[model samples]
Target: MALAFGLAWVLFSIWMSLPWLTDLGNLAHPLIALFVLTFIAYVPGFMNAFLLISLVLRPSSRRETPAQWPSITILIAAYQEEKLIGETLRSIAALEYPGKLEILVLDDGSRDGTAARTRDCQALFSALPNMELKLVREEHNRGKARVLNHGLELASHELIITIDADTRLEKGCITSLVEHLVASPPETVAIAGAVLVANHDESWITRVQQWDYFHGIAAVKRMQGMYYGTLVAQGAFSIYRKQAVIDAGGWPDTVGEDIVLTWSLLRQGLIVRHAEDAIAWTHAPETFTGLAKQRKRWARGMIEALAIHKPLLSMRKMRTMFIWWNLLFVSIDLTFTFAFLPGLVLAFLGIFWLAGPITLLVLPLAALWNLVIYRIQTRMLKRMGVKMEKSLSGFLLYAFIYPLLMQPVSVWGYFAELFGGKKQWN
Candidate 1:
């Protein structure tokens, strides 16, 4: 599918560059330019669609050995999580893993009785046989990476599963994730669990974001896993092999430790797999300001990770193909950042100067393409048993407005990191 898309784009570009196409008129050049830009933007979408279709058609090849379940240490890094800490602990203790599982909650200098609440939860769980809950509190405020590493020092299991304090793992989530690692080769280092929006019913904003996760981010990840590997392992819920992480020098103290660690593991020749069956629910920001801050932090973290790992771009000894694939993904993000204004300008000019019928046809083509992708994505989510209350109209609003609104903020995040802004752990 990627090859077909590339071929189509190349042919389109060559045709547009032809002398006759350029000689058509001023209006013709803009139309040709629009065609070229549309093709370029469509590449990522095409690849994503291809991947999703492939994963859906493929047979399940997971192993069925209960004896192979490895002991897992669950790590939750908390900072002022007074309201959610108890619930997080309760959920971890309730997981149905067959093997031994230890729970560690690290408090990053929270003054709001977070440590006290964690200890109380630990005492509550102390009666459960074979389950150990430990609370490690720091006097000073260290970042999440450091707090996680501190918990790593006391881990008694080879498999370390990291969970955010605000996340709740579904029953049998651990078992589903561990099945993939045991079945795969020993080099499989990290496994990403599926995360659904816990607060989807909260507001319109969260509902839209939930759709984006299920249809956009989650769909792309499942597809990416089919070709080479999963690109980004979301931080909210992920499982990592302790040895692989330690060998990679532990998680980097960055805003996006999950992404950084994923890339680092890839560079070390370790496979990072995505376990779609391993489900967890997490809360999304309900307000626009909160959502913007979250996205900006994410964007800044991506830029910082790219800068620190720039050497991976030219390293031939590593997985060159995968590296190039990741670079292409990043290029798509950067292109989207700058593509909108120019696209709108050319589109308007084409409407005013060129045949009105031609412009009308082009606009609907883009919209229709987007709608088709959304329908496929929504169907996939429904098949996975996710409930959707909002109709197609809500999704349409997101498809048109959200991407354009996010562009300026993403661009701002890129420059902010370049000028030396620290990654806040709030």
Candidate 2:
């Protein structure tokens, strides 16, 4: 599959580089534009193919255990999360760890009853004998990074685990993450745990996000782990060595503190590993409005991180390659979505002039590629024991339609970041 994608990408690149293909006069204007647009669309297809192949080929191993279980401080950064704070606290209180665990809920000046809700969950929080729950309230909205830094100061453990207020951990999440840190010694500074979509069964938006979590996000993390340079430790669920984070200047106040912190740790010669088995379930936005806002924040934050760390763009630094790969991935998605409508218009027009044989040949090929990807994804999910209530229709809708709808919003995010817009955490 990788070889086939490489060959296709090379051919597509060569075809696009031809002056006649891009030149308006060489062919009918519409046809010329379609050809160029088709080439543009192929870039993302090729990149996805490459990523899928990489994920399928990556090596794996059983989770390892450490000789000693280290103490951990779990930090939950919340702002106006009254509805969800109880669940988050309960999940942490249920973690099956024998070592001392400190759970800190930092309410970043929520006007809502988030702090009161945390206090209400005290009974559950106190149920676990080894765990202690503390509430840290801020006078103002200082953002996630600052709240995290404050939690860091109060942490009584060597490892600091940061999770969003809406995130819930699986039974052994903490044990699995901290074990890797202890076994690897000083080299491993941060470990990114896998995050699955929790509200996936609620709406189409969340369902699509679930597939994305499995194929798009987790697949990339798997490949990144092979290189020992996992770029981002998801803010929702990640474990960081306390001293290493402090040494790297605690999480920098950026749009994407997770990515910035990961890059900073790498700069200090610390390894970042992906813990595939350490799973956490997070609630995704249920509506398009919520989804768009989330994507915009993510895209803007990423751009902000890239701009702030411009020095890391040197190819001499390994982070440069990762950054470039990420940029290419985002660009391909943006360009392909923009070109789809125009490409389809030309394809319809060409149907009248071009032979039926050509149309039949191309259409099925495109459809087949999509089917193959879906089947691969379905099999992968079933193997991982992820069952969906909706069947093939849901998967198809998620794969084809969601990306097109989300692309423009992401592009808006890129531009907003470029122009120095603030991303509201709430």
Candidate 3:
């Protein structure tokens, strides 16, 4: 993902350098033309090319496992999530890994029946010869980082897989992830799996989110994995080498501990790879407010991780370049947006002569780019065995609108991270 963004910059610069494209008219400042064109031409082209190459280059099948399967401990962390915890547990119990596996569900002092649900799952799944599920309870409500750190101490195996309480794995997710790990080199410490929206049929918000997951998160991970640049081992469904995590000091106490943990591994020169075939379905925020809060928390986490890992900002490595590029590009985009809006006012007032035709060209170009991404992601969804929702047409129509709507939200996230105190998990 980081590498793609860097390449996007290089690719877009090449696109803008074409004399025929930029010779439309003269501007008071050349960078105004360059920055405007970056969003209009460079972004879409980069995204399309990056996604296609990543998917094409991704490993088609899991490598064959060795004769002896390794032992793994699956950790489930719950905080006030009583309703969906059982289903998650059931899914964990139903996983079809050939290796030895045990599940431990830690209750983070839920005020409801989360602990009871955990007990129920423990009793139900423990009888299975292969599935041995255990229940752990914390006396007080602490954050997820504390629970996971404690889990590391209790884990009996050298490998740990963390699944959120609201997540349900596909039958073969664990097996696939472990296979990917076995296939990975010793320096690669973790693998992040693909996460799909389970409630995709709920609404347009969720449907687009489903679309975004496929195009945005999954595709970007594949690109990063190609170069060992996988940045974040997302907590929803990820596998880790237990000792590597222990050496990195377990999960960091941050709003985005998962991302921070990945960065910590990178600081120690450990590589975090990604496996797309390991699938987990999760519930997304269906309401607008819920979605906004979720995006805010996510943005804040990225900001916090970047702040905590400042030493890597200039390490002259691919991963460092990726992080530095992301921060730089976000700042650049924010600047372009501020200028472009007033530039729009100037164009409407007939001050900037070429702005009209350029605007006309850019919108369709952006939509066309999204359509290309949609077709690619559609194929990925089919191969991943995901069911297309009833609102396929709605998703198609909203692809053009999705990018426009996210601008303010992205800006809000940056501002919130800078000024907001004590971020809450919604």
Q: Model-by-model lDDT, in order?
A: 0.69, 0.73, 0.74
Task: Compare candidates 1 and 3 on lDDT and give the better one.
Answer: 3
Predicted model with the maximum TM-score: 3
lDDT of 2 at 375: 63
For residues 1-426, could you state the per-residue lDDT of candidate 1 as single tens digits?
A: 444544464455445445433443454466754543443434444444334345445445364565756778989999999888888788877877778888888889899978888888876667777688888889999999999998888899988999999998887788878887777777788888888778877777787787677666665566555543675777788888888889888878887777788888876666787776777888888887888788878877776667677766776642444556555545555555564455456667763222222223234434544455466556645655655565355476577777666666766666677787766867
In model 2, residue pairs whose N, Cα or C atoms come closer than 3 Å (at least 3 residues apart or on different chains), thus clashing, are none
Candidate 3 residues 89-166, lDDT tens each? Answer: 888777778778878888888889998888877776756787787878999888889998999899999989998899
lDDT of 2: 0.73
Candidate 2 residue-wise lDDT at 14: 48
Candidate 1 whole-model C-alpha lDDT, 0 to 1: 0.69
- Identify the candidate with maximal lDDT: 3
Regions of candidate 1 where Cα sits further than 4 Å from its true position = 9-61, 314-339, 345-394
Q: Write down the RMSD of all candidates, one decimal each.
A: 4.3, 4.2, 3.9
Better of 2 and 3 by TM-score: 3
Would you give me the overall lDDT of model 3?
A: 0.74
